[model samples]
Target: MGLLPLFTSMLLFSWTTLNAALKITKVDLSIEPSAAVYRDTNVALRCKAEVLTFGTEALNRVYTIYKGDSVIYNKTTSSSEDLLYHLPQARVSNNGKYKCKISIMGEEKASEAATLTVEGMSTPILRFNKANITEGESVTATCLALGETGSLLFSFYDNSKEVENARVTSNELTFVPKGVGNHIIHCSYLVFVMPNSFKSQTSNTVTLTVEELSIEPVLKISPQDNVYEGDTVNITCSVSNVTKDYQAGELLLSQDTELLKSGKTSIHVNWTAHARTPMLTIKCRLYLRDVVKVVNKTISVSELFSVPTLKISALEVFQEDEISLTCRIAAKGIKKKSKVLTIHPKVPVSTPKIWVSGSAILGRKVEIFCLSDTGTPPITYTLWKANKQNQIAIVHEFNKAANFTIVINEPGRLNHYLCKASNGNRTPEQSDKLQTAVIEPMTEAYLMVVPDVDDISEGHTVILICSFLGTPPVTVRWLRDSDDLNPLKTTTTNINTTSYEFVVNKEHTDNYYCQAENRANSVESNKINLVVGMAMWKKLLIPGTIILVVSSLVMVGFILFTRSRRGKRERAAELSVKPASPKSDDSLTVTLTHDTEVYNAATDAASFCDDKEGRVTNGTRGSVASLPADISNRSSYSIPATV
Candidate 1:
């Protein structure tokens, strides 16, 4: 058993020693090489050995071993410290598998393998799942191995081919795509091994698709084209593959201001938006599309024009001169330049030219001469006018003195005058207007009379009044209220000086007036009414006619006298029928009594009858008082009795 333990111990020692002896102690190279070598160039190789002193203090010491007369390197020779080998040139031949032996100072130590492999370059595999990748987006790339241990260095490159860091790792690498282009991306690396001591592992060349910012977003708008002055404009920014979050920068409109976006790619641009009330242009600007910074566009509108300033000047003027008038307007905008223009006429005047003169008159030949001038050109103006019957005197031809009468006709009405002016080619500028009254008397006629009123009495005399107005000496006739009175109505024209007498009677009480009517215009004098009132009695009837009244009165008196005479004769007859009794003389007995007595002619007549006839008793004169009559018997019928 003890032997077994001892033998096991020896065996363990041997195994441990062999294992330690075989261990790779040091792997190193002399004459360091640059990381990159151009194609087809000479490159040198150097190697040193130092694995021989693993268990001792001489662990860092290095040397070489000799083999035959060829002077080859070994563990013991100092030449092994720096063994140099110069290759002919860099080529396929230059590509390599290089080797070196490692040893400690005394014992032949561990031997290991390394490589110097010329990577016959081929471009890496360039591939991208997407051609475009937006910024801030996550992505990954896989480098497929062309050969060897299958590990590589990861690198990033900008569109300019600028190299980024080379980081070594196994399998795929992750990154955020930073820019846009045909991105050429591949990886390079080294392998740990022999003659071809190191192996460069390359990936298949690939293109990484990275997204870039757009130039200007295809500006999407709700109202595609025109927005009114007062309206709002809305624009939306979008990158086909990007979310609104990335486009959430600003939309610059018209360069005036900037606006921030939220989750929305669109924003409302508010404005008062007044466009063409007077015709104008408007613009809008938008920001942050791609590498490009801004954008712009325009809009338009139209407005209205109003009536301008106007009025009149002077009232009246003399003949053979100019009439002063003016027209005015409110000044507006940038004061305008002059233009060519023409004028319209007043009261139907033909070719009424404008002149500088300010005043014009009525009848004497007037002049209106035009002259060229500068300044705000006045609107054209017609000749001054007033009233329907043109009172302005006229001239057919402008005198050589430029004296032209504008008023060929007359007007009898009030009028409005204007100066219609323009800058030969543009809208006009008018001045304050002038008004003038036109009056003429030469072309007219009227009525006149010499003795307007003459000769008259209270229902008796004659009076005549006369007057006239006319172009020429016109004759006049005296008319009583539009009527031609008969010759019997007036005296013969024996009087001179157009004076005539008129008889005033009760019949002429109405209008004893005279009208002296002439051809031109007529005139009449006021009426003369006559009052006829004369003496109360004598004047009423002719004196001779009153004599006839007296004659008729005399006739009536004679008839009454004759009637009284005839009546007296009849009475006398009656009285004679009785005879007087006796003529009692001297002293007739008289008796006065209370009751007076009446004399009885009957008794006397009875006595007279008795005496004539012899009286008998029975016949008693048909009664003695009855009486007989000698006159009665003559047959005058019977007289009425009153006695």
Candidate 2:
């Protein structure tokens, strides 16, 4: 039993040792061309494993390659050689973390991760079919990425703004730009690989210049000389520089706003000139898709003929007289035309009546009108002074009535003036003579005092005559000094002379003037002073009475002287005793009466009579009172009664 237990123990120990020795030891992963490389380059990944086994024969090995956490490659082989994962023409998909794991007989080992990088792409090249083109024309642009493989997206840019994008297999794109002026254009491409995409740098820039279209239309007119009415003209319109490179276009010809013709490149039309439309404007237009060109021209048209006149056959016409009128035109270097009108027994003018517009005043103009009730037009009128041969004025008028103006140089001569009317007749029609009453304005006036103003006396009749050289009816007024409102007398008469009579009195003594007024004017005569004197009878009686009174005083004084002488002797003794006392009878006192009437004279010589008589009377009274008593009484003195 002891020997059997020892044998089991030894067998158990050998089995344990065999099981421990059959485990995998190490794993390693590596890549060929491990540094960064460009896209589309070939790359290889290899995985290595170390195992501890007692057999000398090969074992079945399972290999797996991992990108990130997913298995990308797997293989089962019965060899110990290292395992490899090969990428042909590697792309962006081949650029990530890679790890290798090996499994042999239920034993597995994994390697540390390694990365594969693919870098860079080829730069694009940009090209254009045309660098300079017109605004409406297009340019073809091409983008090329040489030695590049993948699906690519091409983007085109003008300045910095993207214009177009295209996805294509071939590395080419066509681009068209907008607007005019200089443009900078470039292109870039994006390469699409399995899970990622790559972009290439922009290509070289190209400059493009765009310009405006230069196509101008032309217009022409036939018969280039002066154009006249009723003449036909041909007009043509065309354009230049219209080549086969552009699409078919249209051409139009027009006048003002009316279209005349339309065609492909040119057009022709015929038109007639008219007098109403003297000026014309022609226009030609060329039209393409979005472009137009235009041209314009102007023309003038002139007129053909002239105007007409008329004439008469005779200067005077009468009743039952034949007359003729002709219409003619004088066309220089052209056709002459004429027409005649005749009338047998033509109507004669009625007697023409004449009158004046206003009163014919001297030194002023007057208008006279003459009219015929029946007469043809184109009548001639003549004004005569004394007879038919003496013509004052002649007026030719187209109407039946005519007028004339004349100054009234002599109003009396106006009565013989007459007017005559004629219309191609042998004898003119005569009117009744004009009886023009003229108004002569007052020019001179005279105021005369009748009965000799110097001999005027009180209670005598005086006459004031107002005479003027003017036509009547004239108003005559008598004024004293400046008081004209209350005239002493007023009268209106047909004659130029008038008179006013008054009994001379003191109230009538003042400055007197007469105003004579006619229709034309009023005039004042020279002023005269009127005075009243004493009556002629009083002049004779005053001096005679004075003489008689002086004679009577002489007689009384002589009588008184005798009586006093006798009384003186008787009363001598009494007189000597009484010492000469004053007594009423002793001195003979006399009283004389004087005339106090005053007279106003017309002349200075007659004004001193009243004062001379007063002085003489005063001297006589003084002489009488101063004489001695006896001598005073003996003087012959007689006192006359107051006259």
Candidate 3:
């Protein structure tokens, strides 16, 4: 029982303690929450602490929670720290140190303590994502943080005066200040501890940046002065630049309480803003990193971009022409801004589209274009031509310059030419007619006559030869002297060729002429002169007359001999015929010869007797009446006697 026994016991105890300590290091004391609940309402609290090592006796730890001289909770646990605990209820009377103690080797070690002030209701942490309140109307602000479960006195104070108050049981508290001023808030615990009651602490001081109720923030956009549809703009929307844009929205940039644009080389905004505005007002506040209200600025969004002006230009152009055209367009706009140019949907400009007339002759061209003042790729152009026939747009050029040369072909054709250009949305520029002209071609008509006279007989024909030159086929109106020949004898020329033989005659002796005519009612070369030499007049008649005279002489001699014998026979025959005196009527009969000449004559029969009816009476050698004979009589006169 003396020294030896005591030493053995001490050794055993020491070994036990060492074993426990080693095991404790391996013990996982993992906390469940990511952060601490620094404040609380009611304080009926309980926590768990247990030994997990099997080599050691399983034991529970005791816990104590406190706040400002007040004990909030005290409890003993038999389960692991992972275990959950439930108290009958939270009470304002329960508040204090939040700590846990465990027994080991007969020594006490405590867990970290958490103070719980059972104020039941504390002045809420009037916290706002934003610190400064901009000028304008009173604002309702929410204050939030981990707190006790009992009712919380949500309050706002101006220094020491109460500005607002609310009852809250949730983790959050809200308060609204009536005006601008410095404010302080204090929360006193409602719970009492063995040695002391709950203490109160004042909250962080706050100064409301209040100025006035903000009129509904006016809104505006940059370049609002004038704008084109489908154009890109550096757009913004804001209550004020200092209050919202680069200052507030751009990484909390502010001076004192005044909101200012961030100095970042690049601009970034939590939200868009309109910097270009007229009379459009908004509230702005100067600020400090810790949220101090300085000044609120009212600013307007400025017009950063202007409506684009489209300029369309052309050097030359003419009307009534058909040819290619070129047009030029120009425009200006903000950088990094996009703009579109819609050419005159139609190829030509909308205005008197300065263009070459479809009927224009060659040597001239026209141009048309559209331009933008502000925007990317702000110019557009087109070229086109109308034909001489006045047919529209037979050709066109796009996005190019405008210029055209029209080749006129039609006569007296009027060309109404025009051009247009445009920025996708802006009005287009127009050009005037630069030139005008007309064109016509040459035309002609005539008749070709080829005539041949192959026959030239006494009663037959004479060849008449002739021909002509000109356009189209022409009719030959054959003419003999002043007489118009029948078409049957005339020939229609074949294109440029013609030929025909007309009967030759003395009638053709004079000038022979042929006139040609065309569908245009046009006349050609006057009657061509033709000399028709008459062969009939030169050959048969004159020579044949001589032969006729000789024959007649021989015929007269033979007739005399036969006449002597015929007289005796004629007398005997007459006696047998009951010889009667020659009747004067019979002797008065006229005999006609087959000649081109005719004659009528009467001679007195003095020796003839007449009856009462004017009939001639029989008488020896009675006188007779006869037709006048040819002046060149060819016979010898003789008289016959009657019995």
Specify the highest-lDDT model's number. 2
- For model 2, residues 1-643, the per-residue Cα lDDT tens digits are 5988889988888656554556778888888877467777788888888878766857688999998788989999988888888887776546678899988766788999988878877788999889898766777888888767657778888887887554555555554456668899888988765466778899999998888776667899977569875578899988777777756678899888989899887788897754446688888998765567778888886755543445668755556666677665554344434444354444567788888877778878888777777776566778887775443344444343577877777755377788988766448888888887888898888988988878888898999988888988899889999576799998999987889998987677788999988877899998888888888889999999998999899989999987877665454223211114433333322332224322122332123223223222321321111222332233233322111
Q: Where does candidate 1 stray beyond 4 Å?
A: 1-463, 468-505, 511-527, 532-541, 577-643
Please give, for residues 1-643, the per-residue lDDT of candidate 3 as tens digits.
Answer: 8999999999999768655653332212222231122333222334434444544454554544434444545556654454333333343434444554454344354556555443333443555444555443234445443334433444445557754444343424444544454334432222235455443345555455544433222223344434443343342223343333333322233323445344221222232343334433333333322333322334343455553444334323223424443433333443322245343322323343443324333232322222222222223433323412222222233333444444443444334444444434446554453344442211332333334333334345334333444334555555544765454355666464444555545555555554554332334334444445546656676678778877787788779866855664444233222225545444433232333433222212222213112333455343322312331131222222232
**Candidate 1, poorest ten consecutive residues by summed lDDT:** 586-595
Error in Å for residue 602 of model 1: 20
lDDT of 2: 0.73
What are the runs in model 3 whose C-alpha is more than 4 Å off?
Answer: 1-466, 473-476, 479-494, 518-549, 561-643
Q: Number of clashing residue pairs in every model? A: 110, 15, 105
Which is the leading candidate under TM-score?
A: 2
Cα lDDT, all candidates: 0.40, 0.73, 0.40
TM-score for all models, in order of appearance? 0.22, 0.32, 0.20
Candidate 1 positional error at 105, Å:
99
